[model samples]
Target: MPRFLREYFNRNGVGLGSVMLGLVLFWTIGLIILPQLSMLDFSFRPNLPPPEIGGPKDLYTLENYKYLIFGPEGGSQDYNAVDLKVFYRTLIAAVLVTLFNLMLCYPIAYYLAQTNGNHIRILALMLIIPYWINEILRAFALRIIFGESGVLNNLLVGAGVFDTPFDFIRNDIALYAGLGYAYILLMIFPIYNVIESLDRNQIEAARDMGASWTRIHRRVVIPYAKPGISSGCTMVFMLSAGALAAPQILGGPSSLWFTQLIYQQFNDNSDWPQGAAYAVVLLVTCILLVLALMRVFKVNMGDIGK
Candidate 1:
């Protein structure tokens, strides 16, 4: 670590390296560690009211965590079934959204990276323009579009695809689509950056050797883009899991995200400890998923940083 820092200083100059190092340390400690420590503390402690009448006393206990697995009263076989289902759905939906983005973005990223034209700027702007609006607004836009009487259904009906409007927003499809659209840039940019740096000669050579396009991508391009793919997948999964607004706005009655339960704990139930516990569980889940992906992809922290 010391040798790496010394090299960084020699390469980037002492003053700049010192500033960058300090910023990174500050960000890690201030933004990550301290807030998590605070949440951990909150998670362990019981939620207590003011010391007025007969209110619950403030004390550290594992009850909050237990309540998540067991029933609300604890030690029951029948768990918080709704909460458990929502949590499961949230994780599954996040993974699905990540896969969707990978499938949707990979071809586009490849095309964009390989192409050299003025239309690239226009296409990039089209992606960026939607995001220039607020995220909540974008989610609402999707809601409007997917609603029963909205533009999509109207188009389908008008084009004789259906006799009546289909309810897209009332299903999980809209939720996953919204989540994928929400993080499109994150998936595309990382993959594009890596693929753009790959030597075109390798692809040409493979083509010249009568290799199929799939073979070229699978053997040459994918291996080269593994780090970027891993990083993008990690980021998209984390963001999808942690996202609050899109799920709330775009989800139907059947789609209950775990984050919504956490929000209810904090706001509606006024149970800060339980909320903190839920948040901690989510954080741990995301971290574990990241580690698992790293192992599966043979990627390291250094590759993710790049």
Candidate 2:
């Protein structure tokens, strides 16, 4: 730690180093730590009605947490099966979306990195411009595309792919597709940046040795780009898991995301304690998933941003 600090100070100089350190500390404590701590406190408190708000002191209980594991009253043998299922489903869907983005974007990223010309800049602009639009607008656009009278169904009908419009919105397809589209750039840029840094000679040498394209990517490219892969997947998974707008917009009545439930508790139901507990659970789960990914990919904590 001392050596690190010494090196940091030496490289950045004392004035800049101190400023950086101070900003980091402030960000860590003020933004991250304090908010979580306050949420923890709120999670323990009971949800009181407006009429009974000031009537009680220290209305802390485990009711909110219990409501998660067990049912409403906290002592039921059966858990809140609906909430539990939706929570896990949301996590699983987020992972699937991350993997989907990785698969969909990897080739595009590789193409952009490997190719040379003004076309690369054009292609990059096209990728970035969509994301500059509001997320809600993007989601609404997707909603329109997947709606019964939308472009996809019309195309499918025109091509004789389906006799009638398929209910894409009623299912999870639109939700997943919207999320993947929303974060495609996040996945693409990282992998592209890393792959561009790789030595082209390595790929050529492997190709000269009669290595297949698949083999070259597996052996010479993927290992080198693991850090970028990890970073991209981490960002996509975290964002997808926490996403509310896209899901709410694209998901049907049957589709239930954990964030929607949290929103309901905080807004519609006015159960702040329960909402806080759910938020904390989500935050913890995301942290655990991130740690697991870092462990699996052998990435350092500091490498995610790069």
Highest TM-score scorer: 1
Candidate 1: residue pairs that collide:
none
Off by over 4 Å in 1: 1-20, 52-57, 74-77
Query: Which window of ten consecutive residues has the lowest lDDT sum in model 2?
Result: 49-58
User: How would you encode candidate 2's per-residue C-alpha lDDT over 1-306 as one tens digit per residue?
Assistant: 699999999999999999999999999999999998989998998887678765665487888888987868644568898899999999999999999999999999899998889999999999888888999999999988999999999999999999999988998789999999989988998999999998899999999999999999999999888878888999899999999999999998897999999999999998888999999999899899889878877898777777
In the order shown, what is each candidate's alpha-carbon RMSD? 2.7, 2.5
TM-score versus the correct structure, for each prediction: 0.92, 0.91
Q: Which ten residues in a row have the lowest lDDT in candidate 1?
A: 50-59
Best by lDDT: 2
TM-score of 2: 0.91
